[model samples]
Each structure stands twice: as C-alpha cells, then as structure tokens.
Target chain A: MKKATIRNVAELAHVSVASVSRYLNNKAKGRLSEEKAKAIEQAIKDLNYIPNLAARQMATNQSKTIAVVVSNIDDYFSTELFKGASNILRVKGYEAFLLDTNAEQQRERELIKTVSSSFFDGLLFQPLGSNIKTIQSEFIHNIPTVILDRRLATKRWPQVISNNVTASKDATKYFLKQGCDDILILSSEVKIASTRRDRYSGVCAIANPDQIHLIELDEESYNYVTIKNKIESFLLKQKVRNKKTLIFSFKERWLLAFLPMLFADGFLNSDQVLITGFSDTKLVQTILPEARLISQNPYLMGASAAEILLKSLSGEDNSKNYEPLIVPAKF
Target chain B: MKKATIRNVAELAHVSVASVSRYLNNKAKGRLSEEKAKAIEQAIKDLNYIPNLAARQMATNQSKTIAVVVSNIDDYFSTELFKGASNILRVKGYEAFLLDTNAEQQRERELIKTVSSSFFDGLLFQPLGSNIKTIQSEFIHNIPTVILDRRLATKRWPQVISNNVTASKDATKYFLKQGCDDILILSSEVKIASTRRDRYSGVCAIANPDQIHLIELDEESYNYVTIKNKIESFLLKQKVRNKKTLIFSFKERWLLAFLPMLFADGFLNSDQVLITGFSDTKLVQTILPEARLISQNPYLMGASAAEILLKSLSGEDNSKNYEPLIVPAKF
Candidate 1:
C-alpha cells in the first residue's frame, strides 16, 4: 500500500485537486460546502492521510513567538493553562501571545486565520471545533504545535491530556465502596466531547449501566438559576434520597451552583448526600471540605504543552512519533 | 510655548533623533541606558511634549487587531478584564489578542516589542509599572488605546479606572462607622504602586493616620506557606481582640491563604474578629456572608475599556479631553 496524498484524497472525495489543496491549507474561505467537507472528511478517514506539516514548518519557519489559543481567556481552566505555558516561555526568553476564541468555534476559525498569517514560531492550542480535517488544514504541518487538553482522531499532532476517564472511574469506585446505593453523574451541558464521553464510560465500566443515572446541566443556557431549578425538580422526582447517594460533577461551577441550592432545598447533608467533582478550587478547602474531588492540575498540563512546543521550535527533537502525555489526576 | 517634536526631545535629552525614535517606538535594543532613559523621561516632562501618535497612526496605520496586555492572565482581576473586553470585541468583530507579562515589567517590555512590529490597530492596557514617561515612550499615542486600571502623571492617553481610591475610602468609612476601633490594612508587600498608594491614602482620608496599622504581605516571595507562617506570628503578637478589630485585605488570595491557617490556629471567630476585603468572590458569599466586601466589578471595567478603545479606533470621538471613567464599587 502506498502513502495517500492530497491528490488521492481529492480523487476519492470527487473534488478538484485545487479544492483539496485549498481545504488542506485552511483557505476554503467558506467556499467548501458542507457536503464537500463531509466527503473530504470521509475520504481522509478512509485514506489515513497525515498532512506533511513538518516539511512546511522546516522550510519557512525561523520563529521566536509562540501563540497559545484558548476558547476563553477568562475561564479558570484556560487561565491556568495560559499561566503555566507563559511562565515557561518567559524563562526561555520566547514571547508568548494569547488569542481568545470567545468560546465560539467561529471565532476559533478566525483566530487561526489571524495567527496563520502572523510570524509565530509554534502553537499550544486548546481546540474548540473537533474536525480532524479542519485541524490539519488550519494548523500548518511543520509549525511545532501541541494540542492541549483535547483528543483528536488523527495522531499527527501530539496532545497533552489529563486522564479524565481514569479519574472518573476512580471517583465512582470510591463512592461505591463506601456503600452508596445510588449514583448521579452531572456534567456541563450535553456534548459528545471526550471529557463527557470518557467520564461516562469510565463510570459505566464499573457500575451497572442501568443503575447509573446521568443528568445534564442546563445545556441550552448556562443560567445557574435555571440549572438550580432543574436540579430541584429532578431531586424531587427521585422522592427524597433516603439511601446513601453520591453525586459526581465534572466541573467546579456545577458544584458551586448546585451545592447551596441543594442545601436550601433540604436535599443535601453530610449523612446521605456525598458530592464530588473535578477541580482544585481554593474555595474547596475553605467552604466545602466534606466534598471529594479529583485535582486535575491544568497548570502542569499547560506547562508540559509549552515545553513540548518549545522543544519542537528549537529543532532539538525531530521525531514525529511523539507520545500523547496523559497527565494523571489526584483524588 | 511652542510644541516639541521627537527632534526637540532628542536634543533636550542630548541624544540623536534615531535614539529618541527607537525609544519612542520601543525599538531600543538593549542600547538605551538607565541614565539616558531617565534623562529622556525628564526631557519629555520638562518640555511637556506629547508624541503626535495619531499622525503616525493615520500615516502608517491599517489596524484591525487590538492587543490587550495584562500583568497576570490568571489573576481574578485580569481574567474578568479579559472576559469583558473579549466579549465586547467579539460582538464588535475586532480580533482581540492577549499577552501575559506574568506580573513582571521586564516581560511586558518584551511583549510590547513583539506587538509593535505587528499590525495591531489599538491597545487596552493595564500597566504594572507606574512610570508615566516610560508608558508614554513605549505606548504609541496614535493607536487609539486606553490605559486600564493604572494612573499616570501626564493626561496624554485616556484612562478607565475602577476608582480604587474612592472605593477604599468608602470601605474604610463604613468600617469606622461600624466602630472598628483598630483597622489593620493588609496589602501585598511590594514596591509602592498606584493601587497601594491610592488605597492607603483613601483609608487615611477618613481615619486617624496613627490608628491605621498597615502590614506588608510577604510580597518578596509568593509562597503561600511562608506567608501563612508570617501571618500566624503577626496574629499571635496582637492578643487583644476585645475591641472590634477589622482585618482588611487588598486581594482575595490574601484572604483565602490567611483565613484557613488562622482558622486552624483557632485565632479567627465570627463573634470576635470581623473580616472584610475587596472582592466579589463567589466563595466569599458562600463561606463568609458576614464579611463586608466592595464589589469593584472587573467585568464592567473591562467592557467599558473595550468600548472606549473601539470608539477611539473609529475616530468618531476625537476628544483627547475624554474624562476618566471611575467605575464605583458597591457593598
């Protein structure tokens, strides 16, 4: 079997080679239609083609500035990552600049366009839209880049991820071993993202799939009042949690928004309801000492990502077969 | 008095026009000496000169990108600012980028160098260093930029402040009215800056200067444990909790680090010692509702700064006499 190329993908997808080239270069400019994009994606998946990004990187890149693109600059998770990565970059005398996607995929696309034209040495990215073809197209092949906290289908771009799945499994097991009868897993919104999918799977792996109940936060709108009201109704439908019950949340915001509301509704107490989540919030130690949580240090993850990017930027490491670093979470 | 040019400044400072140009353009490549830089600053002040940055901007300007530079991205203050600005910029269709200085002035100098060469349209800055002339020299006047949360001697550049002075005064008066006999001001230990100077002056305006005890937080090292030890020893020295004692902190981190350790030592109690700070922290609401806090909303400040910057960028408001917006803090 021979290696697939852009020409081969274009032939299989039934588009012109020029169109394929434009799409691969992330220069579609909305000219590539949904149908064409789907066909191209399918063809690429079928072909297992990795864009020769490294060759491009090596040719035109003598860069010093590293750009770290995040979904939102203000989000606690993103801030931690930015802090970690920027600190490392600063010590190495490399300039680190930031671009905010505003938590919108459209903005993410726009930012990639802006950065692609800029003189950046490398990239540390927290992906917003998970299209592998789009990723390949927007991210220039040779620019030493590492995808932060995201899992993609293609192994072309190495990633640094916190093992959310293993941590989720361990959190579920801890409650079960403590004689909790019923378990409730609460995640932010309804997304088929790796964080939610893996955490749910990790829970189902140990517990009975039927017994495990999953509740979404107010997915449509992130109104905490709405989420609180929904939780109130949901808890009432269960008709009083008389047995030892454990509720798992995926983010700190959920815990903060739900805990006091639950406490007010007389549904939460130390005796029956045990709450746990994933965060190392400073408030946890002071306010909610009884609640258990898995500390997935995003700072460390960001620093690691920057380190890899800097290594690649320095041309010290040339091998493309970089292993995905799964940062472990602590209970 | 006639207007002074860069040439005039160069002659006044006993340097060449190129050297003055490099300094003003922030193009000084480790060549501008400390003594010469000081002389240039003094010359600018002595001559009362403002660089015609607008003319420069009009001649060589095609800017759609706004670079927001902050001292620290992860700080609650900076995050709120970034969120507010980014949100507004997104709605206005302007590309907003962020650069973190890690709260270091040197890093800020480095970041400015990178951005100046790029084609950014304007700036929304939160200056960490309080050197007004340095700011004037480094910040191009024509970029339609707004100085956020920092005060300067010259009124050449527009500003939007959260009114730390007014807020601090109000907070101090509220406590003094509540019969807080001994008000202990706990500020992060560092060199004198605008925040500290204004806040301290604000506190002094209402209370007896001698009665106000100001303590420097272990600012030299940000090690929370070292701070915890120092605070512990300080609290032990003051055994008299008979009077209404108020511990006023400047930042949230100080409150969080000190409260937990103090609680463990059995030094803090709701009945005897009262706690108050300047933050709108969610945890503060949840944990210590008894504590009084001045909510100087950073989101609103950030949003307002972006609005001002956008207005200037469009050249719709050519008024250099724009009044500084002092966002008032609420209890």
Candidate 2:
C-alpha cells in the first residue's frame, strides 16, 4: 500500500492542502469551519492515518540524531573533533549529542546499549580503550557508524586515524640530526591507544635498540610531581654516559608537566638536549620556544569521520575508500 | 472538568490497564485479541483521549531539555561550568545541550529565537560581550532561566557569579603587604563583563591612582607574537623602575601566554616581582611554582546556576534568595 501523504488527505477531504496542514498543526483557528473540521476528521479516520513520527520511525529506524562517543568531552582534542563533526552534521540536518567515557572501555561498551535503544540514528565512536569485537556489534552494524583516531583489532569499521608514525619518525630524525645519542619517549599510557604505541614505534624505527628509551607512565600516577620525579630519575640514569640526549613526549599533558620541571631544575641545556612532541599546543609551544611540535589536525579527522558516517547513513557505504582516512601531521 | 485518564479508557474498554497501555504504545500483538483492540479504540474515541506527548507539552511547556549558552564551549573555564551543570541536570534526568557564542553578542540574540521555538524548555545563559538589554527578552522572560557570571542590567533573573571582587582584593592586599610600590593588571578585555569590572575595581580600592596600572589587551590582537611583544614592553618598564612590582592577570590565557615569555627571557625573578592570577591552573601552577593563583570555582558557579534554574522550573521561585549566588574564590 502507498503511504498517506498530506496531499492524499487533502484530496479525500476535498479541502486545500494548506488547510489540511493547518488543521493537523492545530493552527486552523477561524480558517477551518465546523463542517470542514468534521469532514477532515472522518477522512483521517477512514484512511487510518498514523502520524509521520510513528510510521516513519517504524519504517526507517532513523531519529535524525547522531551520538558522538569520545574518551573525554572536556579534553582539548576531543572537543576539537566534536566541533568538526558538528559543523558537518548540522549542515546535513542532523543533531549530535556527546557522551564522555572518561577513557574507560567498559563505559563505552555500556554506552552502546543506550545508543542502540532507539536513542540515536547513528554513532561516531572515538574509543579510549577498545577492541574490535565490541565495536563490530550486530546492533551497531544495522546503523551507520564511523570510528575516529583509534585503531581497531579488525578491519571492520570505517576509521579516520592521524599519521602518528610519520610525525614521530620525523621528530626523532630531527633529534638524531642534532647529534643526540640517547632518545627518551615518555607518555601517559603505553598501550591504551594505538597512537601512543605508534609514536613509540616511530622513534624506535629511527634509533638503535640500545640508544632508544621508552617510559610508560601509569594513568593512576599521572601528575606533575610524579612525572617530574620520573624524568629526574631518567635523566640521572642517562647522565652516566654523558650522551647528548633528546626527549619526546607523546601527548600535551606530558610535555606541559615534564618540561617546566626539567627547565626549572636545570635539566635542559640548550646545546645538550632537544625536545619535541605531538600536540597542537600553541601556548606551550610559545612558552617553551626550544621545544618543537608535530601538530596533527584533529578537526579534519573528526570531519572525515562525519563525512563517512553521513555517506553510510545514506546507504552509499563508501567505507571501501575510507577504511582509515589518514590525516597527516605537520611539524 | 477533569482530564480523561488511561484508567478510564481501560474500564470502558473492559480491558486490563496493561493491555490498554500496550495498545496505546502500539505494542499490542495478536495476543491483544481483535475484539479488545476495537473496544480500546472506541473507548479512546469516545473519551476524546489525547497522547501524553501532545497534552503534556501544551499543559507543561516541558521538553525535559535545557540549553546552556556559553561564549566558548571549548574554553577551560566554560566547560568546567558546563560539567557542573550537566552533573546536576543529569541527576534530575534533564539533558543539557551546549551553544558556543564565540564571544558574539549578536549571535546570542539570534540564538534566542531557536531557544524560544521548542528547541529547549529553559535557558542557562553565560553571555560574552552581551549587554543586559540584549539578554532581557520577552521570550526568555516566559522560560526558566538563570544568568551565570555575566551581570544583568536589571535584577529580574537569578544569577550565579564567582566572588571576583573579594578574591581580587585579597590578592591586592597580599601585594600591598609585600611592600610592592608598582602594581600592574593585564586583562584580555576590560569593561565587557561585570566580573572584569569588579576585579578592576577591587584592585583600585586598595591602590592609589599612581600605584595601579591597567593594560587591556584587545581580543583581535591577541596571539603569541603580540602577547610576547606586549609583555616584553611591560616588563621592561617595570624593570626600569628598580622597585618591587606585583602583577595580576584577570584570565588564564593571558597569564599562561605572558609568563612563559617572561620566564624564557630570565625576566621573572621571584625576589624582584610577585605574580598572581585568577584561575585554578593546577598543572600550570605546578610548572610555574612561583606564580600563585586566586582560584575561582567555575564548576560550583555552574552548579549554582543549575540549582536555581531547577528550582524555578519546579515553581519554587528560589530566585529571591539567589539573585546573585556568589561562589567564593580561593587564593
């Protein structure tokens, strides 16, 4: 059977389409006569007309809403990603709501229940600590979703990951060119996300095994005092060889916490050590003029995910080309 | 005179309340026998029963949604306030959506149209560069609203503002006690918001006209290079006097940008000058240990606004007591 449209209701009731619409919206007022109102009501009953909301929802599984799952909404990078996605989503006539998991994989999994229970039409996941199995759900597969900046355990979902390898390798190469014999890579969590792991690997790719150093700070012990203590110990150990050393932090918080303490304690000498990290930290970069950075475009990555999700929502499924949309990092 | 209830429909239809509910929700399967379905339908028509969504909306003006208006959703302070409001709102089962004004007053006024037109049940406005006239809207007057931080032209609405005056005075007094002859205040924008004006007045209350110096950095002209140049000039003049000076910054961005440049130039000597600002810069504080802060609780201010708005929505009218709920700043 054909769907009942406003025009069909108008033709059956022998009323103008505008009048039918106004009556349905409760805006008919004096424009609709008593006889005309009764006639339209009888026509609506005869047609068994269910409202657009009820029928369309049952048929399409579309809410015109999108859910953006992030590690933390308050984080600088996640918000930038949200801004990017929202810019595109709003243009496409969709509303995006945010859910912050606070870097917990368990919460992300739990959040999926809410996302799938007719709350949203689509999902955009930026998992903090997740595997492929949880992401490739039977329920999620029914709706459109795009993952952003996180590597999956399997090649199942469309993804947009920034180029962590090239940027980290370039920063490391810069340090090696400056005659640095020892390089230390410090990060908040070593294996929580592939970004950190890839950054560590990129540095390893350039340097000899003996010359490379990696320090993975546990999340529970992440504070300026603890990070300062760790860096002090690391530098103390490196001093024995009198090697010209270089330091690379994988995230902004680590760089902000570590460098100020190191500079204050006279641990950084202009000629002895060089520093750089991957973060779009204008103020930190300005403050620490000697410390260079590998700036990545989180906003672009977010926008790419939104574009892919939009395409998938339309059933175009251009996931083949965008298995992993690679946004390059700039030094 | 009383509204027809679902229980009345169930009684008239000779069906269980659960069966009536299932039929109304379109959840009734073949188990609801054909006779029961027709009977319930007839009962609904005879009683002139309407769905909860339509009647509840018309009678209660409630969408169970609140819109939080801020200058920048991504800003450190604004997001902290949003987090506080969202925490309380979520407990009350209300979802908060964010709108970033990007510091434009005109855009906020335009956004009022969307907020008024079924987009939200209430408004929590944190205006930037907005005069009270623009905020005092006939549309907004009909809704539950609470102004946060920004002062209104009239005491018509509830407000939640941090104790900018008392905190600024204490910092100035501390500087005065330190025998500081020269005092300088650097702010992002002056006279835009009452919070800024109050902070400026608090400093003026303590210092003589010659003792107090004010520099209001134009927003359009604030970048690393410009900020660095301005701080360089300011510090050069302060250094020329050979007198112990005290510096106060009104916002975190200014302090973060200014201090690093000063430190790199070996210009920030703890013995020569003392620095304090109004922000809870924990990591920044840990990094720049010499710089003290007059910490204001943005989260508490946001929570206070949420509490008042919730009260107004429930018809308790707590605005009389909370005309300007002042959350104290800790130094």
Candidate 3:
C-alpha cells in the first residue's frame, strides 16, 4: 500500500501544498477557497492521512501534554492514582509525561522544577515522603499542578488526596467489628508525612490505646528481610492475637514482605486472623483471600484531582473555596 | 530554612565559587588541587545543594531521559507494563517521558517519528493494536527502540510480548476443566498486530469450532453505549448456554464491558457460569470475586524490555539473534 503524504493530498485537492498545510494545521483562515478546503478535507479522508503532531505542535506552540511527576513508579498507589488522572486527561485530548522521582526526596523536587520550566501545559505530582517542603518551595509554581495520593499539609498550593483518615477509620472499624480488639499498625518514616500520620490516627480512633500496637519502620531500612523479621517479632511479642486486627501498611513494601510470613507462621488462619491493611497490589487477594484491605479509589481521586487542577488553571476561585476533596475508599 | 546554593556551599567550604562550580561540573581536570575537590564534595553534602538538571541538560546536550510512547496511558495493561519498565529505567538514573497515542494509528506512527528526533536517549513503545505496519518503515532506521506488548507482525522489530498462544490455551483448558463447553471469546479488532491473533488461535487449539464464539468490536466506537449494545446483543443471541460456560475477555476493554453485564443480568449465580479473563486490574477480584483470571505480569515484562533495550543500546547483539521475547503470563 502506498503511503499518503502532504503532496498527494494537495495534488488530489487541486491546491498548493502550502494551502493544504494551513488547513491541516487548523489555520483554515482565508488562505484557501471553500471548494479547495472541502476538496482537501475529502482528500485527507480518502487517503486516511494524519498530520504530523510534532510539526503541528512546533507550529502552534501547543502540545497539549501534561507532565506527571511520581515519587516512585513502583508504588502501586501512585501508579493507580496516575491511571485515574491520565484517563481523564487523555479523554480531554492531553498526553501525560510520566516522570519518576525514583523514590528519592531531592530528585522529586528537582524534577518538579524542571517540569515547571519545561514545555508541559500543566503538572500532576506525587511528592516523595521527605520532599514535601521542597516541593512546596520549588516545584508547584508557574504551572498548574495537582498533587495526588499525598496531600499538602499547608494550603500553599492546590492539592488532592484520598480521605486517608476517614478511610483508615472505616477499615479499622471493619476489623474491629470482626472482633479484632488488638490491632497492630505498621508506621513508616513516612509518619513525618501528613498522609501516614492521618492514617495512624485513624487506627487509634477505633481501637483502645492498649489494644492498638504501633510498629515503626524507617523508610530507609525498608527491605524484605528486615521487614519480615520485624513482623515476626511483633507477632511473637503480641503472643495471642485474639481479635481481627489491621496493620496500616504505610506503603506496599511492608505488605509484600508480611504476607509470606502469615502463611509461614500460621498467623493468617482464615476466620481466626482477619488481617487488613492499606495496599495497592492485587496479588494480596491471591495470597490472603480472607484479609480485609483498603483500596484507595486512585482512579476517582486522580480524576477529581485533574478536574480540580484544570479548573484552577482556568482561573476559578478554587484556592479559598475548594475543601479538601475526600474520595471514598473501596474495601 | 534558606535555600541551598552554590554560593552557600562555596562560603561553607571556604572555597572560591568558581572552584566549586568547576568541581561540580567535572571540569577540574588537573586544574583543581585534590584538597579543593574534597572541600567542594563535602560542601555539596553539607548544604545539600544540587545542580539544576535543565541547565545541565542544556549545557551538556544530555537529557538523561527516555521517552516512552504508549498507545494509552490509562489502560491498566499499559500502565502496569510501564510500571515495570519505568522501575528499571529509573534505577539506571534515566527519566521516562510517557506519551499516550490515544490508540490512534496515525498518532502512534507520528509519535515514534517525533521521539526518534527528540532529545531522548532511547524510545520504548507499546504499539497501538495491529496497525504496527505504520511504524515498520521508521523502526528499521535503528534509533534504539524496544517495542513492547504487541509485536510487529510483518516486520520483526526489537519486541517483547506475552506467550499469547500458550497462555490462552492454558486459560482455555482451565475453563474447560471447570466443565465449560459453550465459551464466548471477547476480542478487540484482534489486530493481526501480535498477541490478539495468537491468543485467538490458542483458544482454537483447545476448543471445538462451534463451541468458540468470537466477538470483535469496532475500534473507532469506544463508547460505553456502543460496547454495551454489542455485548448484550451477542449474549442474547446465544441459544444453548446450558452447559457450564466461560466468557474469555481477551482484552481489558472487553472485560471492562463484559463483567458489568454479568453482574447486572445475574450470570454469576454459581461456579457453573465460570467467568475467566486476562486482567491486570485489582478491581477484578473485588468486583468479580468468582471469576478465574490469568493476571499479566506487566511489571516483569516491562523490566525485561528495558533491560533488553539497554543491552541493545550498549551495542549488545544478543537481542537481534533472539526471536521476539515473550514473557509468560502468570496464571
């Protein structure tokens, strides 16, 4: 099959290549007659030719692409949330630039600065646990940015996040209703971050002080072996886990390490131990079918965030009026 | 906190700012004393000052970034596959540019052309369906592109895809073992593109001719109403679904449309109507708990694709001799 080109379309339409280019460039001004314009449109249809996007973008200075800066591409929550935002953005005829922070604190802030100065029309960021301050100081400026998964503690910028406190409380309560009185919640260095802190408090909201066990893990020391040992030791110290308990997996890393131990130590025996956590991996279901888990409505949260940020870009009075949007979680 | 800068670092280390800048830029070749280099490195650590990436890229003509041209960023398969690739690429200190083609055949080809001419070190593409022949001309020019998910049927490009034929047959046998004889296989335009056709043939290997029902939807009409109508009409036409049957949702969009109808029409009564499909969504288990699904190992596939692409870029000829790499689906 012969490939179609600008020349072919121009020849078929009986117009100069320049006129055809102007029409395809969406600059269909009085450069061409109506009959010629109609003929060019018909020729393009007949040939099934699409104008090169690069040339078009360069010509118009409008690429319609948004840059998404995620702290870690491997984080299930971040990826899922991004999926939601990208869905809406793509529907709106925008492409996403999926930039990674590689789970580094400073790298995220640096990338944000780069993105702001880049050709992107807007940005969506998942700030790293330790880079919140820098992100606020250097990242979210000049361009319209919507923060996802993590919330900005201060009202310096427009942001969006899942209803962490409410959702965790609901999840904790679900475990509590299953007769779990002693719930051990895992806390990561991310506790310094607002989302983890809110989720931690949520567990305390449902369980008594003595019944709730908090195990703190350094984000830096988070490895499979170290996590497995900590979980085993925590279970050993608890001795008798009579109630269905929840562990607020500050991130997916803890959950990934904790699951194999449950079966290895006979910790998860279907009805006896109703273990629940905030997780992003679907493999959790295959590993422990009975465990109640919190699924962050990443897609909806992301979509809402994109919609919020785009509205802000259009000069809406969202800065003062927009309440912290609380998207529900799926259990 | 005052922002860290080269001036602050120079002052902290009691060194001239020019010396610090030269050291940071790696231009201190025999020009700076060993003591000066040590002092600058220490000052950099103490102040936590980092060079501007955009400035560095501009000065060195090295962006240290790779653009990923995908068909759709919102698709679970695309996102998960990217998660795998991005994880590896980031670890290697490369930023990824995620470009969504919106499954536009013209744009898919155009994006490849654009990326080839862009400032990216290499390109990773997930070709949009079967129209990959559009890119064959450009791909042969050798700009370090590793095609993924779907392979080029007419021309062999450096590509990665799942073992569609074997995986689909295995999936079909699983459905058959569940006592399902009357099976409906949902497919996309089956894009003689790569896996779709292979997967379809694999199903034929396991099931009899009349037992297999192939339903292909229009790619142009991707609306919810259009998809729902096509599915409902197909299901209503089937006469004897008396035996235990299976609905093989070969693609994500198919499953997205099919599962809802199963719930709405009360098809999920017992294990008799076994719903099985290839899914990458966590919601699959949550929404359709009883369905048997063969999850795509997108993360691993992506990681392997990156590793292979890098190896080729590093001048390794191992990839060329290797037939298209097919990562096995984790059932």
Candidate 4:
C-alpha cells in the first residue's frame, strides 16, 4: 500500500496542505472552523500521515549550529566539560552539535571537513592527545575554531585550557610535602599535547629527571586491565620501606584502569596509596569521593571556547592580542 | 615578527606559492630535487607559515560532515544512543555534529535552520517526546535527514527505531509467565508517543487491565523518593500471599529512582520481585546488573541514522517508510 502524505490528507479533507499542516500542528489556533478541524484530524487518522522532522527542518536557514569535536564518549571529562559549552551556547541561541574523534587523527581530519561542510558557524575541537599538532593547520583557515583541552605548539589560534603546568606542579608539591620522595606519574601520551607536558615539566621542576616515574601508557596497545596490573606491580616492586605512591594522570582512561587495581590490591582501604587524577565525572564522586583529583573546570573551558569562537566568527582581527585563557585546576 | 605565509616562503625559495605549499605538504615527491626540497623547508621554517585544516577541506568539497541532533543532552538515552551513530559516522568518511534540543520544539526548529546554514551535508534528528508532530513537520522541506529512536506520525521521511510493539509485548509476556498477577506499568507521561503506547498495549495484551498497575511520572513534578515509597507500600500491602511484583518502566530514569527504593526496603533479595526497565546506558550494568534491561543499541541506532542520512544526501530517495529498523536489546 502506498504511504499517505500531507497532500493526500489535504486532498481528502478538501483543504490546502498548509491548512492540513496547521491543523495537525495545532497552529491553526481556531482559525479553521470546528468542522474543518475535525475533518483534518479525521483525515490524518484515516491516512496515517506521519510528518518528516528532518525534511521540515531544511526549509529554514537561520539556525545557529555549532559543532564540538572531542576524543571519546565514555569519558566524563569530555561530556561533563561540555556542560560549560552547552550552557553558554544555549543562552547565545546556538544549538550545540557533538562529534567524537574516538582518538583517531585521520578521523579527526575527516570530521573537520564534514563539520565545516555542514555550515556550522563555529567549531570547538578537543583533539586526541597526540594529534593536536597534526590537525593544527586545518583549524586555521576554514572556520572560526577554539581548541579546548589541548594546547598548540604554535601560538596561532584561540584555545581554552587548564593551567596544567601550575596544577601539576601544585599536585606534585603536595605529594612531595607529604614526605613522599619517590613518586610515579602515570601519564597519557595524548595529554602531552596539552597541560600534560606542562604538568610533567612541573614535576621535573621538583624531582630529579630520573626520579620521576613517567610511565607512558600506549592507549592504542593497552586496555584498562593490562594498565591496571602494570601500575600495581610497579608500586609493589618499589622496595622503599615507606611504600608511598603518588600516581598522577591528566586523562581519565588510566584511572578507569587504576581504580580496579586499587581494589584488587586491597590498597583502596586507606589513603595509604596516594593516587590522584584529573577529570570530573559523577561516577568519580560516587565510586571514590575521597580520592584527590585535579578538577579542571570543563564547564568554564567550554564556555570560554564558545566565547572565543563567537568573537572569531564575528571577524575579529586575527593579529589582535587575544590572550590565551587559562583556567586554574581545583584540587 | 611578521608571520610567514605561503607567499613569503615562495619568494624566499624562488618558487611559486603552489610549489612551496606542495613542498611543505610533502606532495613534492619526485617533482622537486632534494636540494630544492631542503631550500623550501628552510624558507618555510624561516617564514613560519601555518596550514589551515578547514581551508584544506574546501578543495575536495567532501567536508565529510554529518549533523546529529538529539532531543536533549541530559537524556541518557539520547547521548548513549548517539554513540552508535557517532561511531558509524566517524568510521565512514564523515564527521558527526551533535545538536541538543533541550527537548524544546522551538529549539529543534531553530537547530534545523542553524544546521542548514553551515556546511553539513545531512542530519540525524531524535524527535522530542513532547510535540514530536510539530518537530517532524519542521524537517520536511530540504536537506537529507534521518530520524532516530522514534517513529514519525506521518510518512514524510524514513526513521530508525526499535520494533516497539513486539519488544513491549515480549517484555509483558516475560512478566506474565513469571507468575506476577499484578504487573505495574511504570512510564513517563509522554506515553502518547508510539513507543510508550506500544508498551502499554503489550501489557494489556497479556495481563488483565484491573490487575495491572500504571504509574505515570510527570516531568514537571517528579518526586522520585515519594513515588518510590508509595510503590513500596503498595507492594507490601498486597492481599494475595502469592502475588509476585513486576515493575516495567519506560526507561532508566524510572529505574534509577525505583531500584534504590527496592534495595533500601530489603525487597531486593526476593526473586518474587522482578525489576526490569527499558533504556540504553552503561548505568544499567553499574547499578543493577541482575535486572533484565531492554538495551536499546544507541551506537547502532546512531550509525544507521548516519548511513540513512548519507544515502539521502547522495540523492537516493530515502523518504517515509513504515518499517523502522529494529535495533534489538543487548541485554
């Protein structure tokens, strides 16, 4: 049987398609007579007319579409951090669109092209740890973009990020002040593109370069369990009678692995093993509320990113000295 | 310092800007001598020209753009379900841009306009539970779009969704065979929508209307604690000694509220009380692993939405089909 359309309903009801549509939408607002309204409703019921939401959307051109490209979906940092951007964008009357790079650089490049073609007024990119520099050039010319969570090697574009250097330095200092001399830093190679490098640099400022246990986790090669065991065994082997461990991570991927190990090793009993990490997810609060965490205000970062992009989109002079906005981390 | 541009590098190397660009891009291959390549690299380094990712995309017209609009970001189903769409869109030669309606019909209409103005090739919209008919009509005029998660009331476009009637009926049968005489149908008030209605019908198909308990949760005034307590007391006061309790929720929001009450009441130990709900989130696994969950495959739904949109964008007639693709529950 052929599917019924708006025209069919209109024809059967002996009215214009617009009137049928208005009646169906309840936009007629009593402009149509009572008899006409009932007839339109009956026609709709009899014909089983279903309107296409997407097709109707294409008629108007004054949409405020903004695309956000991030690394993963499961990460709380990615989603929670977006709260800031979403809140501001909503007030600005812009609809926020999300794109996940899934940590692939090629996919990131492809995403840029796809999002740009979509006529998005602006874009907010949170590149995978290592690929920030790889896609740096693509962001410059085509659209107004703000790089969030990651830092560019060259100071050419607008970016919003946490003060990784100072935050990491402070976190490491806290560990050092707690009388733990040898600390291990479980670092994400991806974060090196952003504050990870700065945080590592901060750690280097305190401890001897050799003293820093900078274990680089290969995201592509290791799953959560494999990395968990590695962190556990590494801590166990350190025969320093103190058995003090301060593990730091800029990305949450490592912590998902770290939490399971802490439970398996029976180290979750107390703060005996000092393990601190970055990110703010509801799960983090529910699972281990006591764990020391570096709360980089994602909401603020998102808002800032949106603000910068809007300014750029408004054709602000590229050479103007718009200072790089750095949000401090809350411990 | 004047930032180095392609033109500056070309002049310094005694070559055309195109030659300089090709050399910088490493597209030179065998066309340029090694000495020339060395000189071009030197000039590029001296000039400090940065490449733009968005501009690079303009050459191919394959911006690889895919717009994904969920009714709201706060809804667990919409975001989690988007995972499937995001994965598929990313894997294919496309990028997914997300839009959040905040569940407002007007915002959805505005989103359509914003998306069309941008460089997006197609759109995937998850209609608002409230006012879906009006939102559906907004997408009828232009651009290729694919609807996800719900069915349209009119046959104006194609939609991807679960086999609502069959799934709901199967769930109701599971409860009936479990020997639950009084099954409670817990759902959101937007039940007039097809999916919820199907679930209600499914319950009516097996159990007596008087024996079934219907709980309608209104969004405007949701007091979860009070509702849970009410349900708990009602279950305890059942006159029949053999009366097993079965709770069927429309989605996880109700489950999140109800399960905690059961656990608190110490009723969680009784197998006589079967708790199951429909939703698509990892939260189900984390909260109550034993509970039978209707796992709507969001990632797959999203991917299919992208696939359908891609086909339509490529000029294939992908409009108005009654047979929505059935995305089975993983659990």
Best by TM-score: 2
Q: Write the per-residue lDDT of candidate 3 for residues B181-294, one digit (tens) a residue.
A: 678777777754577888888888999998888777655464545555655555555424446667788876456544544443444444556666777755454345456687
**What's every prediction's RMSD, in angstroms?**
18.0, 8.4, 11.7, 13.0
lDDT score, candidate 1: 0.68
Over 4 Å off, model 3: A1-61, A130-132, A137-141, A170-178, A215-244, A247-266, A279-295, A316-323, B1-65, B70-94, B99-122, B128-144, B154-156, B160-331
Q: Write the per-residue lDDT of candidate 3 for residues A1-331, one digit (tens) a residue.
A: 3335555777788876546656766664466688888998999899876554322432243457778887655455666666677778767777666776766666666677767755566788777663455666775345667766676665645677767788888887777776765777776664557778788888778778988777776544445456556666766655564444555575654665555445434554445455677766454543444566777666677788888766765666546533566676666
TM-score for each candidate, following the candidate numbering:
0.69, 0.79, 0.57, 0.63
Candidate 1 per-residue C-alpha lDDT over A1-331 given as tens digits, one digit per residue, 9 for 90 to 100: 3345555777799985445544655544267888888888899899875443211221122335678898666456787788888889879966677877766666677767656544456788898655677666774234567998777776667789888778888988998998877678788543545666777787888888755877786432555665566666656655564566677887665665566446544676446667787774455444455567888788899999988887876778777576788988788
TM-score of 3: 0.57
Per-residue lDDT for B1-331 in model 4, tens only? 4334444666788865445545544444457778877787788677665533222222222346667788656556776667677677666666566667755667778777666444556778787663455664565335566778776665555688877667777777887787777777778764646667777776788778888888787643556656776777767775346578888888765665555445534565667778777877655444554666677777677777777777766767545554566677643
TM-score of chain B of 3: 0.77
- Best candidate, DockQ: 2
Error of 3 at B276 (Å): 17
lDDT of 4 by residue, A1-331 (tens): 3335555776788875445545645444367778888887888789766543221222121235577888765565776556678778878776676776766677777777655544456788887764444675444345567778776754556778788877778888888778665677777673446567777888888777656787787645555556666776777665345556677776765665455445534554445467677765433433355666887677678888888776665566575444577877877
Best by lDDT: 2
lDDT of 2 by residue, B1-331 (tens): 2345555777799885446655765433456889999998999899876443222222233446677877765566887787788778878967676665656666567555445543256788787753766566524324567888876666777888888888888889888888888787888677788889889998988888899888787653447777677666776887787777887888876765666556657666457777888884465677667666888888888888998888888887744444577888887
What order do you get sorting by lDDT, best first? 2, 1, 3, 4
True contacts kept of each: 0.17, 0.17, 0.10, 0.10
TM-score of 1: 0.69
